[model samples]
Target: MMVVSTMTSPDTVLDFAHAVALGLSDRPRWLPSRFLYDERGSELFEQICELPEYYLTRAEAAILRRVAPVLRRKTGPVTLVELGSGSSVKTDLLLAAYAEEGASVRYVPVDVSASILRTAAERIEETFPSVNVSGLHGEFEQALPLLEDYGPVMLLFLGSSIGNFNQAESLAFWRRVAAALPRGGWVLLGVDLAKPAAVLEAAYNDAAGVTAAFTRNLFARMNRELGAGLDLAAIGHEARWNPEWQRIEIGARFHRRQTLHVEPLGRRFTIEPGELVMTEISRKYSLPNLTEYLRCFGLATAHTATDDQRRFAVLLLQKGE
Candidate 1:
């Protein structure tokens, strides 16, 4: 198992502190969702994936299972680079398909969490001895520029993670990705299609409460890492669909007035009752619009696959000359 450390622990901590301080000071208090994926948060998210109401994982996996072989044939021999690859459970389908085709592939799983990235790299190496695994430990932005050194590669941005970015951010992000990729490189993007508000709401607010636990884990992370004395019990999980934005906003709603003190920043933030501090946003998209959007970034759609119900889609895109 090979893991490359692109970011040092002190650098990561500083980045986190800056993001937290800036976000908390915003007019509408917010937190960078990326920080929610510490070791514990990652585990909670895996549990949330199994909830029946959370259909995203099942839908994307089904599509990948069906299309992986086709993708292998189309892309020829190329390394698989997955952004924000957590556990990489769904990625096994793609790796297995390549193996069956008698193709020796290299996989690069990039993530912010070191522990999860290391574990995933070891597991993949053990399970698929023929495939080489190189784990990159850092944010997507940090790893994107390094893709040029990897030669021919297929960038996998699965699980609708792009939804975390708003329009401007997404456009900027894809532009950077397109600039980073070698000509003719590929990107397999997973997106959740726009759906009814009720369905979107239920997906995030699962009956099993796993999703809630996963969101609430952010507080635990803040308290432990940032030295922020956050009262986890004082905030409740909230998920609501914003039709105007075509996104589901997940936030922590304070039950009562509370003050949080961060030892690292030596700062204090106060929250009033019912105040919602946005943690994440899952933006749904229309397939047609998304296809056009990618074109602006020099990414042309090569193939598209979706679940039977059209709840989710995994598009195979190529960076053009």
Candidate 2:
């Protein structure tokens, strides 16, 4: 197992402070969703995945299990690089398929949490000794450039994480990914399809309350890391479907007036009652629309597989000449 640190500790702290300061200062405040995954937050998310209401993990995993062998045959021998790979539970299917083919597999799992990345890398190495596992600890922006060193890699951006970005951000992200891959390289992208608002809402607002805890954990993280001293008790979790955006917006709503002081950034923010601070957005996509969008970045859809309900899709895309 090879683990590389692309970002230093101080750099990570400064980045967090900057994001918090900027976000708190904005009107209709919002924080980058990526910041939500510290160690505890990551664990909470794993629990949320198992909830009956959260069909995304099950749907995407089913698609991967069914398609991994085909993907191995199509891509042949190449590195498997997964961005935002949490726990990497679903990735085992792809690795097993590649291993069965006697292919030399090199996996690069990129993520923000160093501890989780290391643990996942170690576990993969133990589970599949034939495969070489290298963990990249940093944001996608920092880790994508290093892909040039991996050679002929099939990038895996699973979990419909692309939905976190809006139109412009997603395009910019794909452009970077396109630049990172060599010609003929592959991409397996998981996407959650547009569904009924009620289903979408239920997925985020699970009856088990795990999803709510996951949202609240972000504020707890801010308080711990940045010394933000946020009133977690006053903050309530909210998940609502925006039909206009075709997305589920998750936010932290203040039930009463609260003041937060981020010691690291020397910034103070005041929140009024009922003020909702957007934490994340999960945008559901139409297959045709997403495929066309990828084409603009030189990624052509090669194959697509979805769950029986068509609630989710895993698109196998190849970089064009």
Candidate 3:
């Protein structure tokens, strides 16, 4: 049985406006990275995963293919809950492993996009008819609490999406997940490890410019949904690697001083020439650093698998008894 739950809180629009207002008003303006995943933006991101310079997805998928059976065996029979399960493309490997392991597999994929979640859920049912599938259409923070109701679940945070959250935020999220899990529950975390600066930079600023389009689509989304008069041409995409932070920052730089009235907030803010409004941050981590991070949340790493290039890793973690 495939069940679909929709979460369209009335405050979502106001929530977006308030978040945008606060972020834009701050010194060194920023737009919440979550805002970058509007419909068109999601489609562009799917393209980005296929780019030659974007090796994170491919590397992580390779590792998952090798470790899927192992993870299935370790977790035994449990529901698989995935956050930000966009398309659930690479998830097939694990789903197959679970089914083959004779586990009573049930998949609960949570994502903010209703259409995407529905499509992915349908495809999953078609592919693994024996497995019960459900789609939770809501933000991770909103949908995660429901995991407790599902019982013995193996949580998945794939695609290196956790990189968007800084250390503090990531730890806080892990705490929430940790609280929801029962004893012996497991979490599969995907992370992109720090690499040469050049490799990191190229991944975000790909030569084919799909990544640029992905960033620019945020401006288009604001103009269309928020009624913001943003001139898309006046801003350009930029991706930079901060060696000190071991993170890649993706943002848009204002070409010139410009002011635009935002109908959503009934306000205008002058954007200075050369000013940058950061859109996303992809933080890379080392094994030791990640281990320490997991420990802070009272979780321990159970196993880790990486591709030959060592560019990405998938860590299987469990809460300490």
Candidate 4:
């Protein structure tokens, strides 16, 4: 009769509350990416992956497919931790490789959804019966300490999740992830590279409008969790790529605009016309940036894989020798 809650921390509620206040407080109210998945958001994202224009999912899968052999060679008792690992399709390759090599892997997936985590844990356990499939339902930033629970971890921040942070934020996050690990630890991250305007733009602003729905679901999530009376119908999704910052920005725009308060955190704000809450930032990286990033964190780059167009890159980092 152990009734364990799926979400591990109270920080998630705080993060969600804070994101809502920031997004709706001032004009041009925006929604945070953390609020995107409320069952509906996760389903929307899964659909997004199937869309013809959203190539990131399929492209990244191909790279992981090619590297299955190299990954299988890694030593056992490996701890595989994924940050923002919802709809983590590429993990199949890793788990299969682990079995073939007689390796027992530990999968630690951290996200901000109880329902998503509950379902994910069930599916992952079914797939990798031998491997210990534990999960932490919290933000990646806060889950650093939890990494200790999965010793000698090979941290994965795949699916262009790193792009969700700004350059400075990315560096700080990297340092935090590196510090959490003992020497000889390894990290594998997927990064979307700067590419042609049309290709990059199309990826985020898909024709089927799945990304838009995914963005708006943030408000729907708040309505459910915080008792905020949000009209999901009044919000729409928009994605913009800033060439200056080399990032993909997603946000929800209030339809007619209005003022709403999230009382749990005790904040009130006005939403403006066509303004964005700035949910996620997908920062495009070049090889130079990736190299400098790992070096600063005391990690040495061991190998890298790139897509056919070199439009995306996956780099593996090892603790300094």
* Model 3 segments more than 4 A misplaced: 8-11, 101-103
Off by over 4 Å in 4: 1-8, 11-15, 23-31, 74-77
Task: Give the lowest summed-lDDT range of ten residues in model 1.
Answer: 2-11
How high is the lDDT of residue 219 in model 1?
A: 83
**What CA root-mean-square deviation does each model show from the true structure?**
1.4, 1.3, 1.5, 2.7
Residue 320 displacement in candidate 3 (angstroms): 1.5
Collision count for each candidate, in order: 0, 0, 0, 7
lDDT of 3 by residue, 1-321 (tens): 789888666227667787778889998888888878777777888899999999999998999999998997787778999999998999998999998845568899988767677888999898887789888888887776787888888889999999999777787788887787776778899999999999999999999999999998988877776787888999899999998888999999999887755667787788988999999999999999889978887788999888998989999998777
Task: Kindly list the per-residue Cα lDDT of model 4 for residues 1-321, writing each as its tens digit.
Answer: 111134445446676788677656555444555666677888888898888887787788888888866865753447888888885567877777765644566777777766676677787677767666777776787777667766777888888878877667777887787778778888888888888778878888898788887887767677777767767777777778889988777776667665666768877666666655777777888898779867988988888888887877877888775
Name the lDDT value of residue 223 in candidate 4.
Answer: 70
Clashing residue pairs, backbone N/CA/C < 3 A, model 1: none
Q: Which residue pairs does candidate 2 place in steric collision?
A: none
Worst 10 residues of 2 by lDDT: 2-11
TM-score of 3: 0.96
* lDDT string, candidate 1, 13-53, tens digits: 66777888888899788988988898888888888888899
State which candidate, 2 or 4, has the greater TM-score. 2
How do the predictions measure up, each by TM-score? 0.97, 0.97, 0.96, 0.89
